[model samples]
Target chain A: MMKILLLLISFPVFAQDFTGCGEYKFKGILKYDEKAPLKMSYLVREGTGSQMTFSLVNKSDVITLAPFIDKPSQFKAKIVKLMDGTKGELRTPMEIGLRFPDPMSASDTGIEKIKSVKCQ
Target chain B: MKATKPFVLPIFLLCLSFSVGHAAEGSKQFYFLGGGGEPEGETTIFDGEVKRVGSFINSSGWNSTVSFNGGHSKTEDLIKSKMGKAKNAGTFSEKNYNDLMNEIIQKLEKGELKSGDQLLISIDTHGAKRSAGKDAEKTHRVALAHSTATELNNLSGARTVDLDKLEKIINLAAEKNVKLGILDFSCYSGNLLNLHNDKVCLISASGPEQYSYATTAVSLGFFTFSYPITFGSKFFDNMKKGKSLEELFIDSRTTGDTPDFPMINTKEGLAINEMMYRFLTPYLNYNYSSTNNFSAGYVRRGDKFEEQVCRMESSHSDFLKLLKQMEEAAAVANESGREEFQNLREALEEYRKYQRGYEETLRQKFDVEKEIKDIFKKQFPNDQKAWEAYAPLDFLSLNLDSSITYYEGLAERDKGKKYFSGMWDSTVAQLKKQKEISEYVKANLSQNGLDKLKAQDEAFAKSGVTYKLSSRISAEAKKVYEALYNKNKSAESNPCRDFVL
Candidate 1:
């Protein structure tokens, strides 16, 4: 039992040393379409879990997180609707939140939630 | 019915004939043969004492060991394959050299060359002004004799061979109406640029006097580091545009820090030259293509891509042309009392803003991803989690209330572990304090005051501190306290979450 515990503790250290985890920086335009360009903001956090969120802002729209989680860190929250009903998604290690695009851009789109647990 | 069917058959036949002819016209055959030689030599300075300078010339000589050896084999293989069933030349001996030159002359005289027949030759060997004694002089003397500007010009039927032999070859290719290019991987290869002509293009390895050899592997020759293998695909694709030889060379050499390699066309009244120039200038003017478009003879380095793209755009005279047009239009509008100035200004401003915002969004995203990766390094020092998550993350919620809470929980979970505890505690404490300060300022400081305080605090906290308290209290207590403080402070007077949970 002691040996097993020691192995478990040492596993992360060994794994980290081998992993080439360093920052990668790049710059390129986010093209959604020919027109209707939305200024996009992205934040991705990974630790015990992984979470990704995108915030898109434009004239006449102010969007914030739509779904509230009891534990935001354990999961990710995606802002699905702004003042106008533009859609987006928030992804976490075990769950996913999706929002629908405006009817003008994409009609018949709906919000989707997917649940799965991933161990890193 | 029979007459109508006959007419339809003729129409179909005509269309088929046209399509087949088009396909044949579009097809191109490109052949490339490149060689580089950097002979290690000892130079003796005839000052009272003979100072013998040893073998190393430049980085190109030392770094190109692997590339040179590999390039030689590859070139030999390619040439042999092309010359299959023809007389095989055993080596680069005098007899073989004469045979090869004869073969080229025979091909030219036979009119076997077509408009799209591409011939690429690259030679990156040392050129000696004076012959050295015996052994060292033999191979190096070829540049002075058979490969000299005058010899090549005489062979190619050029009036004057003042330019480098490489330049003369390209000019001959033009006269023969064949697409020709040469990648010269030698020091002073750029000398060919002075002899630019419509039919010829030269891509040099480096600036004049700068050694163009390799430090890592056996240096192949000039243009070995930058040519056909690296940017061959793009070059072939560009050839389909029917660009002049000059245009093609300019575009090829515009990618790196080497001096602008010139492309020249001597043929007058040729539309191909102008077309090639117009098509290739846009690509060559920038160090990087806007679309990560790789060209023949070039590789993209990630660090320099964006800056190169920006520099290319800023250097373009087209933008200035547009500005001049705008100004003229504005002046006319003002004279006519149309007040279109506001409209024009607004339009340009809006366009500029949109471009700026688009670039900013990409920059921010890149920064965020980088930050997240960095944090992962901190959280899972030796773990692959950070690397794996690099491409997937949006922005790191460094300033988010939830982020604070999450880290707090992680700290609690890490209780009883003193390994890196000091580092973790200090980071958490500093972050907590920062949040507290931000909140305090938000409630009390004016915008200007807040900015000043931020600058001062950031300067003071840049290196950060590792708080080592000499107390019996568990490390978890300090972490828990910091987390709670930060969470509450970021929430802006909101009640703290139930810590017991």
Candidate 2:
């Protein structure tokens, strides 16, 4: 029983998916109905296995994401409302698109993708 | 129907058996009515109402205080001279108004506003209706005094006591287990109903499009002058008989004219009936003394239904222990004492009644919680996303999408499509709250970690796709809820026995 438990612990779980670790600049429109996008910056913290945290600046929002057991390389982040200050409203539909920094390329920051990788 | 099978009966039973207890001896009723501008405007009406309502409640044997800008006459001259603004503005300086509201909140936080108290606040002042845009309307607010620049450039600054600040004050009162009743006698005051919550009753002097009427004849607004004058005596009579605020509103008498149709939102049919009665009745007790009564249980705001449930259980357990101790003391006192025995007997009686009221209110709240769960189960029987999103519906204020989603589902199920559709339409008018919550989260969640996370998620997304993440988010929410509710249970086991009488 002990050996089996050890084996199970050692086994690589195929379920865990993308790991979007490290700081990234995230931008998204607060209101989906409206065309204007509110640009926000975030610090991304990726944990050992499946958890990832995103701390948004300016808006002072923090979000955590978890990978689905069935969906490979795809993580889910909660739907949150963002404020549209220009309209004097805090309820804007928010979506975050993250990009890593790249000093060499003026337009090309590191890929806009969450670095998808297998569980260790 | 099949979807409701698993949760329907169990949730109903849970609600039926649910009751939470709050034990606090000092219940102080606070009344803050400020019509910033008095002489130039019909703020004298505010002054009259203050005296009428204050004296009326006091005469009914309740400890009450009335705070307003009675001395604003001197301050007004100083502010106008300092800013070179209009002399007839009649409102207090913005700083003074903010300071008054802040003082009230500070006292409440300091336990001046205890559990089982009533907070009746009315603000009668000049108002302004500012549009965020063409699409957004009806965020009406009380206009305070203004700076010279603000007055010259834009008069919107006068609308300082906006919906968000008012909502914060009401939420604080609710947190203290205090019943909240607000009356706004300003232009477009009907929009003030956006502050409505459980245990809260709001009355606005005018509808969204109308202006509150102030007649020179009475030196006051019609609603302010009419409500207490026409119904003050009867309202107090019914109140003594344990009538709830909603009942008082429904049975209230009105005279003269209904030019500015008053709007009220009680969130009726919830546990508020018992909550308000319990909070207000103590004021009616002729023997009521702030220093004598002893409080035994605890009241803390919980973030989730499960946490609230556990807290209720613990509180009830503590209440039972207190009762047992009192009974033993009463038995010993017959042989050994007189005053202690009488005090014990009185404490037991008052506590039992208060405990019963608390439990009833808790059960009532659970009924609503159960209904929300039932609606979720019936609407999205197999959908995980819907279940997770709606789980928080029982805890926090319902966001627009969730409300519309629930109502639409109800419309689908019920044979009376007309009624449900109308309900859905009325909810659509309240989409402005979505904005209010968004701003509140941004301002309040800057410090706490978990709260910040929850606040961020509350920011409504552009579409339904974002809600898919709720399936994962629900687990974290449940853990946080459990931690919050269980944090104080360790101290509950040892009964509180230090009160002098």
Candidate 3:
């Protein structure tokens, strides 16, 4: 019950759909385990975005997001829990921006909008 | 037509001599009105600026407007009362903009304008872009034209200033030892960095390749609402007080209005230009931004990510050849610049290795998507309705909670470990900022009205699926990235790499 309540409390802060199921289900992109090496593990997308049709690699440091297109395109995103339950990736734990295709990001088609979920 | 040719040169000379005859006559500023006109929703801001600026000039005894022509502006009546149109336009065209610029340049060259004299231009029109340089994909350009003769939609007949030509003219004006300031409240205005200099200051509403706009609440250009220097702010008062161009630009950035980042050029902007030119010359379009400290980054796309990478691959190859010629042709002043160049060289050299691997990963992803489609077809190939539902490429549609966890897992490993430090420090800073902002922009702002999705988070977390196919895809991507970077190689391509045959 306490664990469930903790997840419930953390949902708003996490944003993307990161639920605690297995290791594959809990870690955030660019978010490293404090116990892990500084930059030994991260996932890079195979195709255009973090589409379900992807494969995750455990041995890279860069986490590139999807590029923008000509029209009102859509993509899936999720919130991730960081090491220590906060952002501590790439040596800047204080920087909390974790969403993909930033609304503030530039494009010709106005501001690109994104939807995200976080790890519980 | 042929008969009239003999008179053309003499007439041109006569006009040149005639234009040179009129000096600035000790005018303090050359305030001009332009950007032609806008549509119904956007017209109000242009109209408001005209009335306000025109009134300010008229009320002041300086009486220093070059000529105000709103060009079929709804507020034409107000313009006549104050500015006394020198040349009225049914609608402003690119020709009109060019003519105005020509007149200003002619005046500057001949007018004997001295130090502290100003040539001020304000642009509030539709923006467009075109190719730059010998290779179309390698270089890009920004133009603040489309000062139309009619509605913006009737673009075939409209005239807009060519950015290349505008840059040359603006820079020429700068060379006259006169102060030049431009307030371009249009899209792609920031990309016109060639016009940047101490003698000139430009405030663009949006960065390069970005669309600039206002909120649903009103159609005011983002710069209009900005503090201190904006139209709604103390524009006239600030002008009278002699605010420097730099101060006005800084003030504008402090209260950035649109979702798009506004840009101002300083020495830092020169650095930003380097990153934009060197790092971003590969693609025709991508989402990117710059910081006051010269940091800039472009977002990666899943759809055409490969194409952009491929561009960088080929462009990087050509760039190495140019770098090789540098010692013979040119030399960077600082030793550090050389060192930095070496590092960058190493990074570029390493590109094709991972690029080829990324291609493999993409093929695997497509193959997986194809497999999912095939599975659905085999299960219910006869049912057309079912096929339609499964048509979209959502191979494994996990619940919102599951989606979050999976992404987090990927991100957790990402850590943005640098494969090499060949890129500039500012470039690295920008890449980091882009990733952070990308996530931050989504989390803080209101998302696509999906309250329904949030409610599903808790219940859906329990329905996590572990497909064998998904794992296989993950393994493929892992191999590709592992070859490129790890935490251990964190010095950022330190020893430097030069692509040897």
Best by DockQ: 2
Q: Name the top TM-score candidate.
A: 3
Question: Which regions of candidate 2 fall more than 4 Å away from where they truly are?
Answer: A1-120, B1-26, B38-47, B57-65, B70-92, B107-112, B134-139, B145-159, B215-244, B267-501
A69-118 per-residue lDDT for model 3 (tens digits): 01122223232334333222222111112322232222211111132334
* Global Cα lDDT for candidate 2: 0.36
DockQ score of candidate 2?
Answer: 0.03
**Candidate 3, backbone clash total:** 57
Where's the lowest-lDDT run of ten residues in candidate 1 chain B? Answer: B44-53
Candidate closer to the true structure by TM-score (higher is better), 1 or 3 = 3
Candidate 1: lDDT of B395? 19
Which sequence of candidate numbers ranks them by lDDT, best first?
A: 3, 2, 1
Candidates sorted on DockQ, descending: 2, 3, 1
lDDT of 3 by residue, B146-166 (tens): 333231111222333444455
lDDT of candidate 1 over B1-501, digit per residue (tens): 446665898899999999997676521322222222211122100100000000111111111111111123444453344233323335333344444445554555566655555554434333211112232111111221122122110111111111133433455566876655554443334444445554454454432222232111123565222122212212322332334443443343323222122222223212222322232223221112111111211212224437864764564335434434644764765533223323323433433343344344444444443444454555445533222321223212225365456445545755666633333354355445435533432454345443443443343242121111101111221222222222223322110011000
lDDT of 2 by residue, B137-233 (tens): 3345454433111221112122244545667777787788666677676665666765666556776655443345442213234442323332222
TM-score of model number 2, chain B: 0.37
Give Cα distance to truth, residue B79, candidate 2, Å.
20
